[model samples]
Target: MIEMINIGLPDAIAYRIEGKITEKEMKTVLAIFRKKIKKNEKLIIYQEVVSIGGVEFNAMIEKWKFFLAFGLSHFSRIAVVTHKKWIHKLVDLEGKLFKSIEMRGFSKEEKDQAIEFLS
Candidate 1:
C-alpha cells in the first residue's frame, strides 16, 4: 500500500510505502505528479518505506513511462527513508546516475534529516 504524507509544502510531497505496490496505486501517484507538473511546480519527493513486498510489473512499466514522458527536470530532490541498507546503497547509485535530482537515503531514525535535506 502507498499512503501520501503531508509535509506542509506546496511543491513537495511525501509518501509512506508498505507491502506490494499495485498498478492502480502507481497510476494514482502518476496522476499526482502530472498535476504538479501541469502547475509548473518544481517537485521534491520524500518517501518513507516501512516495507516493500514488491512492485507489480505493470506498475514498473507505468513508472518508466512517466519518466520517459516527463523526464526528471521537474524534480529538484528526492529523499528516501527506509530501514534497508541495500536500499540506501541503491539510492546512492541512483544519485550518481540521475545527476539533476539530488537523491538521498536516510535510515528511519534520520527521517528528520531527510526532510531537512529536502528543505
Candidate 2:
C-alpha cells in the first residue's frame, strides 16, 4: 500500500509505502507525477518506506516504463527514509546515476532531516 503524505510543498510530494505494491497503486503515483510534469514543475520526492513486502512484477515494470518515458527529467531531488541498511546503500548507488537529481537516504529517525533536504 502507498499513501500520499501532504508536506505543504507545491513542487514536492511525499508517500508512505508499505506492503506490496500493485500496478494500480503504481498508476496512481504516476498520475500524480504526470500532473506535476504537465505544470512544468520539477519534483522533489520524499518516500518513507515503512515496510516493503514486495512489488508486483507488473508494478515494477510499469514504474520503470513511466520513469524511462517521462520521469527522470522531471525529478529534482529524492529523499528516501527507511530503516533498512540495504535500501540506504542502494539509494546511494542509484543517486550517482542521475546527475540532475540529488538523491539521499535518511534513517527513519532522521525523517525531519529528509524533509529539510527536500526543502
Candidate 3:
C-alpha cells in the first residue's frame, strides 16, 4: 500500500510504503503531485518505508514513465527513512540517477535527521 505522508508543508511531498504498490494509486498520487508542483520548482520528497512487499509491474512502469517524462531534477532534495537494507540500497542507487539532487537514506531511527536534512 502507498500512503501519502502529510507534514502540512506546501513544497514537501512524502509517502509511506507498506506493501506492494499499485499503478492506479501511483497514477492518482502522481497526478496530485504534478498539479501541486510547478515546473522547475524545487521540491523536497520523502519516502518513509515501513515495509515494501515489492511493486506491481504496471506500477514500476508508471514510475519509469513519470521519471522519463518529468525527470527527477525537479526535486532538489529527497530523503528516505527505512531500516530495510534493500530499501536503503535502492534509494542510494536511484539517487545516483539525479546527481543534481541532494539525496540521503536514513535508518528508521533517524527519521528526524532525515527531515532535518531536507529542511
Candidate 4:
C-alpha cells in the first residue's frame, strides 16, 4: 500500500509503503506522477517502506509503463526511510541507474535528517 505524506510542500512527494504493492495501487501512483508532470511540478519523493514483500505481477507492468513514460527521472531527489538494509541497498543501487535524480536512504530513526536532506 502507498499513501501520500504531506510535508507542507506541494512538490515534495512523500509516501508510506507497506506490505505487497498491487497493480491497482501502482496505477493510481502513476496517475499522480503524470498529473504532477503535466502541472510542471518538480518532484522530490520520500518513501517510507516497511515490510515490503513484493509487488504483484501486474504491478510490474505498471512500473514499466511509469519507467517508460517518465524514465523514472522526473524526480530531482528521492529519500527512502527504512529499517531494512536490503531495501536501503536496493534503492542506493538503483540510484545509479538514474543520473537525474539523487537517491538517499535514511534509517527509520533519521526521518528528520531525511527531510532535511531532501529539502
Candidate 5:
C-alpha cells in the first residue's frame, strides 16, 4: 500500500510505501505526479519504502517501466528512504542515467537528512 502525504508545498510530494504495491497504487502515484508536473515546473519527491517483500516482481517491473517512461524531465530532486543496502547501491550507480533529476538514497536514520535535502 502507498499513502501520500501532501506537504502543501508546490515543490514537494511525499509518499510512504508499505505492504504490497498494486497497479492501482502505481496509477494513483503516476496520476498525482502528472498533475504535480503540470502545476509545478520542478518537484521534489520524497519516497519512503519500508518493505519490498510484499511487492510482486512483475508489478515492480511494470512500475519501473512506468518511471523510466516518465523520465527526469519533471522532477528536480528525488530522495529515497530505504533500509536495503542493495537498493542504495543501485540508486547510486544508476542515478546518473536520469538527466535532470538528482537522486539520493538514504537509510532509515537519514530520513530527516533526506527531507532536509529535498526541502
Candidate 6:
C-alpha cells in the first residue's frame, strides 16, 4: 500500500509504503508524479519504505524502471527512510547512476533529517 502526505510545498511530495505494493499503487504514485512534474520540472521526493516482504519481484522491477526513468529527470533529490540495510545499500548504489538527482538513505530515526533535506 502507498499513502501520500501533502506537505503543501510545490517541490515536496512525501509518501509512505507498507504491506504489499501492487500495480495499482504504482499507478497511483505515477499519476501524482506526473502531476508534480507538470507543475514543476524539478521536485523533491521523500519515501518511507516500511516493508518489501509482500512485494513481488517482477512488480518491483517494473516499478523500479518507472521510477528511474521519471524520477531521474524530474526530481532534484530523493530521501529514502528505511530500517532495512539492504534497501539503504541499494539506494546508495542507485544514486551513483543519476547525475541530476541525489539519493540518500536514512534510518527511521532520521525521518526529520530526511524531511529537512527535501525541504
lDDT of 5 by residue, 1-119 (tens): 88897644557778988888877777787777778777766778988888764866666776788678766677788888999898799878767777567899999999888888887
**Regions of candidate 2 where Cα sits further than 4 Å from its true position:** none
Best by TM-score: 1
Order of quality (TM-score): 1, 2, 4, 3, 6, 5
Give the winner by lDDT.
Answer: 1
- Candidate 5's C-alpha runs over 4 A off are 6-10, 54-70
* Tens digits of lDDT, candidate 1, 4-109: 8897655678889999999999999889999989999878999989999999999999999999999989999999999999999999999999899899999999
Error of 1 at 85 (Å): 0.5
Q: Model 2, range 30-73, lDDT digits (tens) per residue?
A: 88988888889888899999899899999989899987888588
What overall lDDT goes with each candidate model?
0.92, 0.90, 0.82, 0.84, 0.80, 0.81
Evaluate model 2: give its lDDT.
Answer: 0.90
Candidate 3 CA-lDDT value? 0.82
In model 2, the Cα lDDT at residue 89 comes to 95
Please give the lDDT score for candidate 1: 0.92
Off by over 4 Å in 1: none
Global lDDT of model 4: 0.84
Ranking under lDDT, best-scoring first? 1, 2, 4, 3, 6, 5
lDDT of 6: 0.81
Better of 3 and 5 by lDDT: 3
CA error at residue 71 for candidate 4, angstroms:
1.2
Error of 5 at 95 (Å): 1.8
Tens digit of per-residue lDDT, candidate 6, span 1-119: 88887645557778888988777777777777788787776768889999864866666776787778765677788999999999999889889977578899999999888878787
* Number of backbone-clashing residue pairs for each candidate, in the order shown: 0, 0, 1, 0, 0, 0
Model 2 TM-score is 0.93
TM agreement with the true structure for every prediction: 0.94, 0.93, 0.85, 0.90, 0.79, 0.81
